[model samples]
Structures are given as structure tokens and as C-alpha cells.
Target: MPSLIRPVLATGSLNRAPQPTLPADGGLVLRPWRAEDAPAVHEAYQDPLLHQWHGRSSGCEQEAAGWIARWRASWETERGAQWAVADGGTDELLGRVALRQVLLGDGVAEVAYWTVARARGRGVAVRATTALTRWALEDVGFHRLELMHSTANRASCRVATKAGFAPEGTRRSALLHPDGWHDMHLHARVRGD
Candidate 1:
């Protein structure tokens, strides 16, 4: 007969509470999405510029709710983090910035973001993206971060450049947009760079 010996457990809390949310930066805060954000998200999607740039149309409330639910789940699981950029004063959703495609083993990740049409040319995307990049590299311990933009999106390219991402190269026919197969410009920022 084999004897079973159970290991003793530590006399302390086995499960700790979840970490607090990311702190606000400057006058803008980037935090997890909420159910209430669906309306703003839906409206942002309705912008013609977003549809043209992102190749997708606006969703109904139900659809937006589902999207928000997925985002909340991802946040809880630590698989990814998506922020609803808001004005610190008014707390209105300006857009979203996400750190996704997390390769934990390789310590790498990718960034994606958009600002409402009304927020464009005001440095909203730039500020939000820069804040997210700093958080990913410093707080999340990501070694490499990359952003890919369609060759035709010169505005996005400018954002990447302004955010201190170096132009890595181009991926030929890397994305199939609404127009057709398009070349993608890759930009990257490495840790300590």
C-alpha cells in the first residue's frame, strides 16, 4: 500500500486581489473599457474616416456590448489590455488604444489605436499612443513593440514617427483592406530605445 503525504500550505492568503487600474497620465486617462462606453464606441465606428481606414462599419448596441464584454474578459485574464482614452476633466471617450498580440515568452507586443474624427489633429492619438507605449515597455516589461499602418495612411505613419517608433520596413501585400491588398509600413520601438 502506497502512503499519501500531503504538502503543507503556507499560512497566508492564497489568492490576492487584482491589481489596481493604470494611473492617469497628464490630463488624459487610459483605462479599461466599460459597458457604458458602447455608445461612444458605436458612434466612433460610424465615422466615415474610421470605416475607410479600418475597413469596418459601425455595430448596433448589442454588437457593441459583445465587443465590450470581450474586452473586459481580456483585461481580467491579463491576455491583453484595451484602454478607453478619456478626457481627465470630462471623462468622455476620445478613442481607444490597445496593447495586444502579447507574446509573453518573447516579451513582445503590438499596438493599435484610433481617435474619433473630431479628435484628429489635436494630438490625441499621439499622446494616448505614447502613454500606452511607455506603460507597455515599462510596466508590462515588453521588450519590443510594433505598429503597422497601411501605406496609404500617411497620418498614422506620422503618428508612429512622432511617437518615437523607427521605421522598420514594409511588408508587401500584408493587409487586405477595403480597397485591395495593401503594403504595410512597420515601425518599432525596442526597450531602452
Candidate 2:
């Protein structure tokens, strides 16, 4: 009988990885969110598309500030990493890319991202997703990364596909939105894939 399991090297606690600026073409870069970025965060959340899919957003400066604070706390606790996708030249916020649901014990994590309206159709999400995936799989040593989206979110599907996440299957009624239960498309990528 062949062994069915491969041992994953333990990565230990997720100490904040040396916040490196990831590659982003067309004068974009991935960096940590800043206090002053609250306005941008607030503005991005104003897009109806974000509210439709995410179900929540920073409606005001206070909320956006708290949102950024939570992200910082998550980094401290090894729960997640949220990076601001920004224009490298102007430091203008374009969008966000994140690694969430980090289960180090299982060597797995999930990638999520959204682009502001101004950043849409520019491949910002795809590039940011790809960069984050590489950093998680290579630098952070996660064995697998998952990307799930509402089935109706075709644009997200494309982003996941372009970022090298292959669709596995659908999870019926996996998520609940404002309207009702939503079927989710599951996609995943393993290290070296």
C-alpha cells in the first residue's frame, strides 16, 4: 500500500512577514494600509458592486479607520493579511488583496480581493491576487490557497482563473446574501501548481 499523506513542514506562528512591497505592473504596488488611507477605503466601499458581493463596507471615515485597525490586529494574531493595492507613483489606493482563513495547521489559506471602480478592467485584482498567492505559497509556506466566490460573480471567476486558481466544483447554497442563499464556485491552487 502506498502512503496517502505527505507531511507539510510546519511554518510555526505567522509572525508578520517582513512587509515587503509586491510586484504590481503599470505603476502599482502592494503595501500595508495606512491611517490616512481611510478616505480611500471609504470611497471604494461606496461602489454598489462591493456592497452587493461583500455585504458590508466602510461607510464612513470612522468605520474605515476601524477596518484598517482590525486588519492590523489580524496580522498580529496570524489570522490574515490585507494589503492595499496602490498606485506606486501617487500612493493612491486602487484596491485590496488579502489572505484570509489562514489555517497553518492544515497548511491552507484563502485569497480574496476587490478592485475599486477606477481600478477595474486594469488587471489590478489579478496581479495582486497572483502576487499574494506567490507570497503565501512560497514565502509564508502555505501548501494550498483557496478562492471562493458567488457563482454570479463572473468577474471574480475570471480573476481567480487568471491568477492560476483552478475550479474544483460548486458548493450549493454555501453563502447567504441580502437576497438569499448563494451558490459558490470553489477554486484552489496548491504550491507549485
Candidate 3:
């Protein structure tokens, strides 16, 4: 029988998407995605790890470009933010880290990421995720950030752990995949955690 009402809002500085260049150890950079990255994105989607966990593929350069366009649109609409993790030395596309399911009013969001085959086993996902998490908590002012992964995706679980998202147990059959249902592990980092 608790109350369900809430206070009214003000026009805060949370509407616009933040553009930041986050640098990590060992020469990795997280920046906004670009249309010219379409080819690299299309190629990265060919990795079996991405297919196994994400269940979707860009398939072609045009579709990849379309994906980038959608990410850009989300920024303008203040719905989501996607970043391309690149090598600082060469500026080549290494992977992608994104904050999706953004609920600005509630100060909650979800993080997801994938690295190309060449970028695997190099801490690229972990570094990029850590940088994104810092920005989300400090600069973006979200109170809670979540990282969810299929139970079978051990690599992603490690990345989440390294990024300081503590495991909060699994949700039974929470995600549907190409093969069948997947139990997803819910990991999160709160503002004061």
C-alpha cells in the first residue's frame, strides 16, 4: 500500500548525449561511431563470438552503415550512446561499446560490447567498458549501470567483472536466442558501490 506518486521534473542537463574520448591503458580509445567504420563493423560481425551471444549480424557494409546511422539517431533523441573502440596509435576500429536501454529519468542504463576477432584476448572490451562505466556514472550521472550476458558467454562475464559490475545472479530464460532460451546473468554497479 505504498504511494506510487513521484515529484515533478525540471529541464536538467541530461537531454543531450555526451561526446567524450575516453583513453584506457595500453593504447585504447573510446569515441563516437562513424559512418566510415561500416566495413570494419561488417567484418567484426563475422566473429562467431558476436553471433553466438548477440544473435544478430550486420551482414553487409550497407546494413552496417545503417546500424551506425541508427546509433547516431539515438544520440539525437537522447535514447542511447554507442562508441567505437579504436587503437590510439593507428586509429583502426577494434570493437564497440554501447550504453543501451537508457532511462535518463530513472538514472539507469545497460552496457553491451563486442570485440573483433583480432581484438579478442587483448582486454579491449574490458578497457572500453571500464571507460564507459566511469563516464556513465560520473559525467552522465546515471545512478545504476547494468551489464547482462548469456550464461554461456564466459568471456563477456569476465569483461563485466573486470569493469566492476558485480554479479547479481541470473534471470531464468530471460533472453531468447537462435538456439533456444538463455539464462542471463545480471551484473551491476551502483553510484556508491
Give the clash count for each candidate.
Answer: 0, 0, 0
Record all residue pairs in model 1 with backbone atoms less than 3 Å apart, i.e. clashing: none
Residue-by-residue lDDT tens digits, candidate 3, 1-193: 7647432211243444356678877899987888999999999888777888889887789999999999877766667888899999999999989889877767888999989999899899999998889888887678899999999989999999999999999999999988899999999998877
TM per candidate: 0.87, 0.92, 0.91
User: Candidate 1, residues 88-143: lDDT per residue as tens digits?
Assistant: 88988888888777655566678889998888898888888899888778765677
Task: Report lDDT (Cα) of residue 157, candidate 3.
Answer: 94
Q: Per-residue alpha-carbon lDDT of model 2 for 23-126, expressed as tens digits?
A: 77677789988889888899999898998899886758999999999986777777788899998898889999988987777788899999999989989999
- Per-candidate local distance difference test: 0.79, 0.87, 0.85
Q: Give the runs in model 2 whose Cα sits over 4 Å from its true position.
A: 1-13
Estimate the Cα RMSD of every predicted model relative to the unseen true structure: 6.9, 3.2, 2.7
Off by over 4 Å in 3: 1-18
What TM-score does candidate 1 reach?
Answer: 0.87
Output the TM-score of candidate 2.
0.92
- Candidate 3 vs. true structure, TM-score: 0.91
lDDT pick, better of 1 and 3: 3
